[model samples]
Target: MKRIIIASVAAAALVGGGTAFAVASDGTDSARSSSTAFQATAARASLSDAAHAALKAVPGTLDSIERDHGRWEADVLGQDGTWHEVTLDANAKVIDQRVDRDTDAEDAAEAKALRNADVSATEAARKASSGTVTSVEFDDDRTPVWEVETVTNHKERDLTVDAHSGKVTQAPADDDHGDDDSGDDD
Candidate 1:
């Protein structure tokens, strides 16, 4: 009788452990499916749509818009003379917005550049490539250009379009991940 009881308990524990493992595996699969769905939705989003959504939500002048980490982020100069950071979901829905209290000279310069830019973000994206635009931001490089990122055939391409002349050029690869190989902090 004692031996039978021990065997029964052991079998029950093994079955319970297997059931738990199956449940955990299903949970992982569900999470993966949800993530894939989100990426698909984000892929359908366009720079134009995200810009419109951000502007509508914040009621401000769009300084820059970029798709980062599966969401759309926009920097805008509010009518109140304050900078704002707006985050939008994959569907271009405003998810969160915050005032940029730590405004700096760079922010002002970007705004000024946007005001003087002859090529609109939409225009730059159109001229840059036929790929899906992921980001559009004005870079105040020596020549001043609109840096655009796009995904074509599952590959990311970075191009710079002249802010004034609308000329497009392939941007040099940015392999430096803050390594500072030159050993110069400045």
Candidate 2:
């Protein structure tokens, strides 16, 4: 399933705008359905139109982009594999660009952490509360844990899965800044 999803994402890498999204089963006993639902939303979202617009103010291709609360945070993977963080305003204009950072070491750390992970993000979502996966990201550092977001009880809640132990725990109030949220421009 992981390989299939990866292949799907790879095949859809260069896609833009809103795409189809797969929603997981709802872990409730209400009239809500408990099956995968196809919705219109980008799957990979390596970059968004706004992110690309903001990219005009930066240099590099999009590695990953996620909503940081109210703003869009993007990782611009440089041609040389270096990583830079680009923050976009509500209008999709570049508001801040972080300094260039080495992705080699960070990549290695994340790979190692994931290598030891027993629960995949999908499995973590199952262990969470049968909620649909909204997003999955690391701790923004060398942490092997994965932060999984799922919509349950008609709201989005975050769960942390230990990369090494596969333990699931409720994450904080979606407020943690690391390499992705690093830097403050003058």
Task: Name the candidate that leads on lDDT.
Answer: 1
lDDT of candidate 1 over 62-160, digit per residue (tens): 767998766789988777768899998867888999998997888778777777888877789889866988888878757778889998877889999
User: Could you list the CA RMSD of all candidates, in the order they appear?
Assistant: 11.8, 16.9
Best by TM-score: 1
Model 2 misplaced regions, further than 4 Å: 1-102, 140-143, 175-186
Q: What tens digits encode model 2's per-residue C-alpha lDDT throughout 1-186?
A: 744664465446324333445544444655455565554333333223555664566654444455554356766554454567877754566778875555577675554554456655435544655464545555536556667677666677878877556788888664445546646453
Per-model TM-score on C-alpha atoms: 0.69, 0.39
Poorest stretch of ten by lDDT in candidate 2:
39-48
Which whole-number lDDT from 0 to 100 does residue 34 have in model 2? 52
